[model samples]
Target: MRAVLLFAVFVALLAATAVFAYYGLAGPEEVALGVHGWTAMIIGVIFSILVGVGLMGLMFFSSRHGYDEPPQVRKDR
Candidate 1:
C-alpha cells in the first residue's frame, strides 16, 4: 500500500514537471537546448516513469533476495 501511494505521488509529480517543461514555464530559450516544448515534456514524463519503475523493480528484487543487510555483527565478549 505504501509503495503504491509513493508510486502514485511520484507519477503525479513527474506529470506536473512534464507539463511545466512543455509549456515553456521556464522560458522559450530552453527549447533550443534539446527537445521542443511538448516533445520535451512527453519525453521527460516517459523517462521518469521508466526510470522510476525500473528502480522500484530493482529495489523489490534486492529485498526479495535479501540483499539488504546490516553490517554490524552481534557478539558476546
Candidate 2:
C-alpha cells in the first residue's frame, strides 16, 4: 500500500514536470543559436563525454587491478 502511494506520487510529479517543461519551452519568446553558440555547445558536449569516458575507464582499471578490494591487516608483521 505504501509503495503504491509512493509510486502514484512519483508518477504525478513526473507528469507535472512534463507539463511544466512543455509550457516553459513553448513560451512566446523565440531564441536562436548562432554559429558560435553551436560551436561552444558542441565543444561542451564533447568535453563532457570525454570526461565521463575517462572516469569510467579509470573505475574499470582500478576494479580489475584489485584497487577496489578491502585492505587486509598484516598479522604476521
Candidate 3:
C-alpha cells in the first residue's frame, strides 16, 4: 500500500513536470541562452542532471542516518 501510494505520487509529479515542460515553463527563457530551441533543450538537460545528482545525494545522506541500525541492534538478540 505504501509502495502504491509512493508510485502514485511519483506518477503525479511526472505528469506535472511533463505539463510544465510542454508549456515551456521548464525551458530556458533568458537572453543569454540565445532564445532558441537547442538552448532550451540544453537547459532542460542540465537542469535534469543537476536535480538528479542532488536527489541522489539527498538519498545517500538520508539512508545513512535513517536506515542505519542502532548500536544496541547490532548486538546478538
Candidate 4:
C-alpha cells in the first residue's frame, strides 16, 4: 500500500540520518558532540519538524476551507 511504502521510506531516511550523524559527529578528528550539543540538535530538529508540519496542516486547512480557491467575478445590474 501507499502508506506502507511511505512508512518504509521514512524509516530508511531516519536510519540514514542516524548513521550519518554518528559518523559526522565522531569524525576521524575524534570530535564529539557534548550533551549540550545533542540537546540543541534534538530541540532544533523537533522545532523544524513542528514548523514544517504546522505549515502543511495550515495549507491543507486553508484549502479545505476554500481559502485557496480562485476569485469570483461579480456583475452589477
Q: Provide backbone clash counts, one per model.
A: 0, 0, 0, 0
**Model 2, 1-77: lDDT tens per residue?**
99999999999999999999888867655665678988999999999999999999999999999999999899997
| Model 3, residue pairs in steric clash | none
The total of clashing pairs for model 2 equals 0
Question: Which residue pairs in candidate 2 have backbone atoms (N, alpha carbon, C) closer than 3 angstroms, thus clashing?
Answer: none
In TM-score terms, which candidate is top?
2
**TM-score of every model versus the real structure:** 0.47, 0.67, 0.41, 0.62
lDDT of 3 at 50: 100
TM-score computed on alpha carbons, candidate 2: 0.67
The ten-residue window of minimal lDDT in model 4 covers 25-34
Candidate 4 backbone collisions, by pair: none
Ranking by TM-score: 2, 4, 1, 3
* Regions of model 1 farther than 4 Å from truth: 1-35, 72-77
Write one digit per residue (lDDT tens) for candidate 4, span 1-77. 99999999999999999999988867777566779989999999999999999999999999999999999888784
CA RMSD, predictions in order: 9.2, 2.4, 9.0, 5.9
Count backbone clashes in candidate 4.
0
**Best prediction by lDDT:** 4
Q: Relative to the true structure, how large is the alpha-carbon lDDT of every model?
A: 0.86, 0.93, 0.82, 0.93
Mind giving the per-residue lDDT tens digits that candidate 1 earns over 2-62? 9999999999999999998877656676445544766888999999999999999999999
